[model samples]
Target: MLALTNATVITGDGRTLLARATVLAADGRITGLRAGSGVPAGARVLDLEGDYLLPGFINSHVHGVTFGPLFASGAPPLAEEAIRRNLVRHLAAGTTTVLSVDGFALPEEVAEAQHLSPLTIKTSAGLTPAALTAAQAVDGAGLTERHLAASLKEQVEAGAVAIGEAGSGHTLGGGGSEYMYIPRRIKEETGVEISPAQARALKEAALGKELDPAARDEAALQAALAGAGLAGRLTPARAQALIAACVLPGLKPARRSIAEAAATARHFGLPLIAHTAPPSLAAVLAAARAGTRTIAAHTNHDSFTAGAMLAAARALKRAGAILDGATFDSFGARRTTESPANLVTLLKAGLVDLITTDYGGGFFDPLPLALKAIVGAGILPLPAAVRLLTAAPAAALPGLAPERGRIAPGYIADLTVLARADLARVRYVFIGGRQVFSSEVTSGITSSSDV
Candidate 1:
């Protein structure tokens, strides 16, 4: 039994707030909650000192936090140590549940990861024919005969909650091409190396943002080559050819897979998460129109201008798609999606339905820090901002722990205690009424004797 007293409780419903409340928990469930509730005689009590207490966060679209098929590219698994470290980072970030949208991990792999961590980890499946072909085209080194032979129905029956992350950047001329394939191919062929941004500029210049072959511009391609340090070494045609080889082979197949994936998701009564960047937006919109419950992943992809992003959001909403924004190293590395401007635009327009941290090549920002940005900008109130990481995601993915995203009585006591001055400072975290982490404790000793 535990009693958390004197906390400003955000109920995770985007509105209800309790001032200086006491939340009592026993046996992993919230036993009682109210203002000035007296602690029972034998219960342990922890004073919050008027700090903010809320439901532990639920990040529905995460990646690279498990020892499984890495990404939609079906790359090799990350080491067990790395997977544990990533899960610990998430635990300390106030996240209690996360859906690994890597899109190719098997249910058994997810179960294995769950056995290794305290966090509740869920997975989505992607075993469509086109998805596999696309993965094979790029990097299927991680996949085995079991993965290749597994059907979506079998995987879902084996406990995969959803179908998604289909047609990813690795196969669709998005982040994967810029960061991994384009640079690798360019360096192997031409000794000069370029950054992901430079690669993106070159690809856009040659094939345009839509990856259309006919959209190539000779002058733009020449300028991009010079900018990327390929000026004298290769002709415009050669540079174009290099980029085409890296992106075009799997582009059409991956795009075609979106519709197939959506149909499969619909048949299974599962939500479909699809890549929603400039290159794949059309296909995603088409999937949404076809009546699949579609989640437009990363609508704020840096490739879009403010206008383009807003327009895309509007179109997706019109097509009955749910729009999600990712804090992809935006505040720290600025590697893939450079700025949080698109997120701001989405929030200001009330276009975003959920928020997540898409793995920014392992530099993803914490969910609380993203909420800090939102609250600091006055884009949303603290409660509303917090909802995107809590109730919203829980509602979006029903297979997620639906009872854990609120502070109401009878709910699972998955709670996060945060400092009022800095929302990102996670002081303590409790999952299912068990105190799993505390900032004041180190090596079995409290940092302050007063604690």
Candidate 2:
């Protein structure tokens, strides 16, 4: 028996609060939740000292955090040490569960990842015919015969909870090209180093946002080349050819796989988490129109202008798609997303159903910090921000959480304790009623018999 007392508890339902509460847990399940102080007799207790207790965050769209084929491109799996380090980062950031959206990992690999960490890891399957073909075309170095041969139904039976990340940056002419492939090619060919933003400018100037070859602008491409310091190193035409070569390989097949994966997910009555960005907007809207249960992953993609994103989000929501806002290191390293304004806009307008941390090249911001940014800006109250990360995601993913997203009786005792003043400062973490992390020693909180 364990008792957590004297806490300001925020139930994960988005609007329930119990000040100075005492919560009881036993056998890894919450046994009671009540306001005011009263630690039951003979129970082990951790007095929270007025900290805010919240349900552990549930992130539905994450990549590169497990020992699986990395991303939708089917690159090699991360090293075992790197995988464990990523899991620890999530755990320390107050996330208790995460769904690996890499979409190509075998069941045994998923299980091995779960076995490597205490965090509850879930997997998604995306090895349909078109999706596999796209993977092969783009970068299928990690894909094995087993991965290619596995069917969606087989993956579901083996414990995959969702179907996603159908069209990724690697396949679409999106961030993967800007941040990775295009830069690699340019460095190899011209010995020029460009940032992701610079790479994006060059790609879009030549191919446009929709990646249409007919939309090319030579003048704009020349300006982009000069801005990226490649004026003498490469001509506009040569650069366009290189960018096209890097982005167009898996483009058509990858676009086809979005609908294919959506149809397969709908056929199985599962949620389809499609990559939502400027390039994939039409297909994503079509998926929603097809009556598939769709989660528009990362609707606040850096590729979208605020108005465009809002319009796209509105259309998808009206078409029955759930909009997912992502924290792609915008609040932290500012690597992928340069600003938090887009996320704030979606949240303020109430267009976002859930919030997640998509791996920003493995530098994704913690979900707690994202919550802090939302709540701190007054766009949402703390309770509402908490819900988007906890209850809402659990509900969206169905089997992903079942009974683990709320700090209520009968739910699993996966809870996070944060400083009342700074929500990002995690003071303690309890997973399955076991204390997995504690900053209490440095936070001036000490165990005592007093209520």
Candidate 3:
């Protein structure tokens, strides 16, 4: 048995607290959580000097791409190793679980390129995107399509648990408005013109190559929607495309999205994860209308009134759907709050359903999740910040809410020991009942940047 004494236990399970308390864990699961005067007998006690013992964070939408900053040029990075490093980094930041997507170098050859470079070089200076220029940095490259699929399958093969942040819902130009409108002249001067007709033709061709006759047909339809404006007017092509893509925002039918996400989930039994921003509400609602129980990673950014939230909730309810919350990190110091605090906005609206980090947000740590709650959500207490991250999402996903994300009896041993300085702090961290990181270890041999 392992016992931690003198720790301020934040049992993320909604208001359960143990001041200067002791926690016991056995067999990698929390066996006991309560307030006691001294350490339990026969337990290996680790003395914590009034630090916070909370559930390890579960970030639902962190990107492997965040490491792109650390990488330069060379071969595609070592994805698994980079992921491990990121996991360790998240651990140090009090995050125990993370959901990663995108920024993996594609083309199966990139994986081989990874094996060619030094661990530091490959892990930091990722393998370059072939068929491109040399000497430029773009964070991390995405995994080859085949490799991403294989990686997902590998998670299954390796008995790693599944959590979906698929990020497949929206494409680059799909957002339409608010995207940096690169007018035709810039492309023309660069000899890179993305004509709607050409884009349509290419999409049609790609669809035909997909072998899924239905999707191919849908792709052709999507091309048409692109050619015509999404909201300007519904031309025949727009109607047909909407029918084909089946993912039009607001008033769109939900068949296409339903079919696609269902196929993905069946293959992996993973949940459909949707990232809903203020503008993407309509499309997200359309998806929910299609009978998908998706995780709404960041539906917290709701616009005032029911125009957005109501449409989505109604559609989701009609489809018998549920979703998860994503507390996205506010841009560094741009916003007053951290990400998790954003929950109070939803919570005040009585929308506190599912909550998780859009982990590996543009900023660092689960602390942002907590800080956002205080600032964005107009909250002041630290305990409340803790629950939004731990309990809310736990109630959403299985094998999670009750078992992990908190300091409690009969819970998973995964926990984060954090030192606080107003909004941010770092002393040491523990994961799965082991001291996985310490500032002391990070001090001598290596710079803490990679941790």
Candidate number of the best lDDT = 2
RMSD of each: 2.5, 1.6, 11.5
TM per model? 0.95, 0.97, 0.59
What are the runs in model 3 whose C-alpha is more than 4 Å off? 41-43, 65-85, 102-145, 148-258, 266-269, 278-283, 286-291, 301-323, 331-344, 359-361, 372-384, 399-402, 420-423, 439-451
Q: Residue 90 of model 2: what lDDT? A: 93
The clash numbers for all candidates, in the given order, read: 0, 0, 29
Rank by lDDT (best first): 2, 1, 3
How far out, in Å, is residue 408 in model 3? Answer: 2.8
lDDT of 1 at 353: 89
| Runs of candidate 2 exceeding 4 Å displacement | 442-451
Could you tell me the TM-score of candidate 3? 0.59
For residue 42, model 3's alpha carbon misses the true position, in angstroms, by 5.8
> How close to the true structure is residue 252 of candidate 3, measured as C-alpha lDDT?
20
**Deviation in Å, model 1, residue 11 alpha carbon:** 0.9
**Pairs with backbone N, CA or C atoms under 3 Å apart (clashes), candidate 2:** none
Model 1: colliding residue pairs: none
| Tens-digit lDDT track of model 2 for 27-58 | 99999998876767777777788989999989
lDDT (CA) for every model shown?
A: 0.86, 0.87, 0.45
